[model samples]
Target: MPTVAQIEQALFQLAPKDLAFDWDNVGHLEGSPDQEVQRVLVALDVTENVVSEAEKLGCQLIVSHHPLMNVRWHQAEMQTLRPDRYLGRLLRRLVKADISVISMHTNLDIAPGGVNDALAEALRIEDPGPMPGDETGLCRVGRLRNPVKLSDFAGEVCKALHANGVRYAGDRPVEYIAVGGGACGDEIDAVIAAGCDTFVTSDLTYHQFLDAAPKGINLIDAGHFPTEDPVCAKIVAYLEKEFPQLIIIKSTSHKEVIQYFVEGE
Candidate 1:
């Protein structure tokens, strides 16, 4: 069994804490460093359900992409210090369950063979490279083996990501593509400079789609959960290799929360 500190060390080497953005929180957020961890669970977010799953599975640690203890402006007045508040309840439960937490956010996005690499793999992009003018490597530019229609490519994005729904703009061929998982819709300029014909990401504004359409760049909003969930499996595999003696589990309770409702279905 590896200690919590040892696992954090391995994760840091993979996505160094120094690489994280100034506003971002990464690495160990809670729990004792010296505690032993034999079973680890991985998830995209540290929701209450995910915490319950870890407790049920007897996991000693949870590796998630989003930090669990983030403070929002609206939540600031909720008395997070009290055990009854939303965040406070989760924190108390985690402490009582003895489950440690490690978050890899923007650091993982920019790290080589991290979130961007996993996204490229999920889309079956060939010879993916860092997006143009992106020194941090927050996005990837790549090409499909064979060119496909923009409509067909949108379908592929939905299928590949297992998305409940997807939105797209553009009517043209697609071969060269760029991707930035999890709310990176603003990188259209960089994607264009990379010579990509299409961009796949999430949280694209209506005007953003209109702006990119006439430029001949197809934009696909694949939903944030679908865009980033692929990295969770990669994290599991990486940790499994690092700690072969321990049991690693991806959270079963973690899934896309939003569902699309079509009329007359």
Candidate 2:
């Protein structure tokens, strides 16, 4: 049986801790490093439901993309675990259950076969490679098989990510495309510089859309969850291959936080 530290070492090979952002927490977030692990659960976020799912499935470790410990301070250490609050209650439950956790954020996004790569694959981008001027490899630039209308391209994005809806700017033809999973709208300029006429990412602001419209770069806000969730299954596959003896499961309780409901007929 593998230990938490041993699995962590394998994870590090895929998404190294040194590649993580300076402030971003990536690595063991909780539990004993030497604790033995028989099963592991992978999820996009470590929410209360994900924790419960792990416990129900008898998973000894929970590997997630977003860091549940990315707080300004160690709120989990606070004396009281308020039942009324989600964070406090979640922390208390994890401690009581003695479950281990690992979060790979920015490091996973930049790693090869990571978040951005998964997005590019889903979109059918050709010759996908790192975005120009993006030293961290956080953004990927590629070309479509043929040019398509902005609206049609957006629909393709929605289908690929299983998104409820997609918001975009610009109505021209799209060929070259760029993708940055999660909130990475800041790379719009780099996308343009890379000769990409369209950008696919999440958390695009009103001002960002306005700014990109004039530059002829169509921008699509595909929602953070859909943009990154594909990587969760990828993680499960990797872990399954790396540790065949251990049981690897993806959380059934996790789903998109945002939904698009049509108006009443």
Candidate 3:
């Protein structure tokens, strides 16, 4: 079995926390480095359900996309609005149960062949290139070598990712396209300059969609978790290769924040 420190170094080399913004908390947030790895769990978010699921699966470590450690906690009130309260509780449970927490968010995004690359491959975008100003090197500029109808593209995304649904902006026939792993509305100019006629990502403001439409670029609002969750397997695959003895488990919790259907009348 690999030691926690060794596995950690492997993950860090793949996604250095320094690649992330100073404010974005990432890397190992719980447990000692020297701890022996028994089993590992990977997730898009570190939630209480995830913690419990890991506990049940006999996973002693959790690798998540979003950090439970993001933002400082000057308050101990344990309120719902508290940034870390809920996740803190989950971590506490893990700590109590001897489970460790690790995350790769922006850091993973910035890593070479990281989240965006994974997404691009999944989306089958051709002629992939790196995002501009990515001195740390996150977000790739890519094009679809073959055109896909806008709805067909969305449907393909759902099939490829096993997503519940996908949202979009623009009409049929996407000649050129841009795809960022999670919510990446700020990359509009880069997408335009990259000569993409359409963009696919999570979380699009209606106004931003409206603005992009005029520019002749289509926007797709795939759900955040759906867009990101598939990459959990990538982390597991990396770990499985790096440390053969280290057992890495996919997160069992389908903790979707958004519901697809409303209450029946």
The candidate maximizing lDDT is 2
lDDT of 1: 0.89
State each model's CA lDDT, in order: 0.89, 0.89, 0.77
lDDT of 1 by residue, 1-265 (tens): 7999999999998998888878787899899999999999999999999999999999999999988765442258345556767777888899999999999998999888888889999999999988878766799988898999988988888999999989999877999889999989768887887788899999999899988778878899999999999999999999999999999999889999889997898
lDDT of 3 at 105: 88
Question: Against the true structure, what is each candidate's TM-score?
Answer: 0.95, 0.94, 0.88
After superposing candidate 3 on the true structure, give the runs of residues whose Cα lies further than 4 Å from its correct spot: 72-85, 132-136, 262-265
Candidates, ranked, TM-score: 1, 2, 3
How much is the lDDT of residue 91 in candidate 3?
55
> Which pairs of residues collide in candidate 3?
167-221
> Best candidate per TM-score, number?
1
Q: Which regions in candidate 2 have their CA more than 4 angstroms from the true location?
A: 72-84, 262-265
Give residue 67's lDDT in candidate 3 (0 to 100).
79
Model 1 vs. true fold: TM: 0.95
Q: Candidate 3 at 186: error in angstroms? A: 1.2
Model 1, residue pairs in steric clash: none
lDDT of 2 by residue, 1-265 (tens): 9999999899999988888888888899889999899999999999989999999998899999998787544555455568777777887788789899988899999999999999999899999998888876799988998999999999999998999888999866999899999999888888888888899999989999988778878999999999999899899999999999999998889988787776782
